[model samples]
Target: MKPVDSPERTKNRTRSGRRGGESTTRTDILTAARHLFGENGFTKTSMRSIATEAGVDVALVSYHFGSKRGLFTAVMEVPGDPISRVTAAASGPRSDLGRRLITTFTSIWENDDMGVALQAMLRSAVNDDGAAKAFGDFASGEMMPALAKTAGLSQETVRAIGSCVFGLALMRYLIRAESFTSLTVDELVDQFGPKIQAIVDQGR
Candidate 1:
């Protein structure tokens, strides 16, 4: 007859094996957290849910990311050459600049993976001030400056141009304004890019 296993011994074996087999590290935690937060907005996702999704303990999630907000901030930050892509697309042929700009932005927004990251950030921005600041920093630090430089516009003029673009993005994307939705990309360019171009052309 085999010796009876002690309850405490079995518990220890299970716990040790659990960590040994499936311990989640920082990168794993971040990946899991981003997925949950992306699918279910910031407020809806929880540490426990992230751990469950990651197949780790909730404590591990806290240990790695510090808190939900930290994880969220991390999730919002996507690494890319934002300036390079936009400037490259916007650089040549001033006559086609407007079309190029609109098309490039639309293409970025439509890309599935990038779209999830952007939507996650946008959702966070809708509810959190810190997220909004991060979004602004990313745009102002990289995207706006690069775009303005590409267009050869001054700081003040860039601000005006950014405002118009922001207004268009908000109405068309976030708000889904009926008037703006259902319009083709070319139609949007024809209607709005000229207005943006006028500001860029003035540069005051």
Candidate 2:
């Protein structure tokens, strides 16, 4: 007869194998998600693939992230290029900062990956309060600080500009409002630039 492994040894083997500790398993899922999403994009990547890459059960992925949208939102917490892009826009002539910022934002949203990311974020935020807070924190922590430091802007001005950006993003990108869609990017910059400038002036 085959020798039976002790119960303690069997338990140790289970923990040491692909099924890691709880926190370790959570981190593995996120790591797997980032790699797959970056390589395959959101639509092509699935929960099963992510779990497979992480060497965990699909149910564990669900237990941690709740859903694919939730996982995407969680993945977004890993830093992205938006902060760098914002820094570039802000680190420019103070006079036309508004136009630069608007231009930068519009261009970003136009990218396919970013557009999908926005959809995931908006959809996930609908029911999950933590998802909404993550976005708010990213805006306040990364985007706001970059603008405030590079452009000599106050928190209030940055907040107002952020509001305008988010509002336009929601209406133009997410909601697909015809009124917003009717305008070209140049037209958007033309119309919104001065408004942002006025806010920037106030914060000075």
- Any runs in candidate 2 off by more than 4 Å, and if so which? 1-16, 19-74, 77-79
Model 1 Cα lDDT, one tens digit per residue, 30-62: 788766655665656789998888788899878
Global fold similarity of model 2 (TM-score) = 0.66
lDDT of 2 by residue, 161-191 (tens): 9999889988887788999989998899999
Local distance difference test scores for all models: 0.70, 0.80
Model 1 CA deviation exceeding 4 Å by range: 1-24, 28-74, 77-80
- Residue 107 displacement (Å), model 1: 2.0
Total backbone collisions, model 2: 0
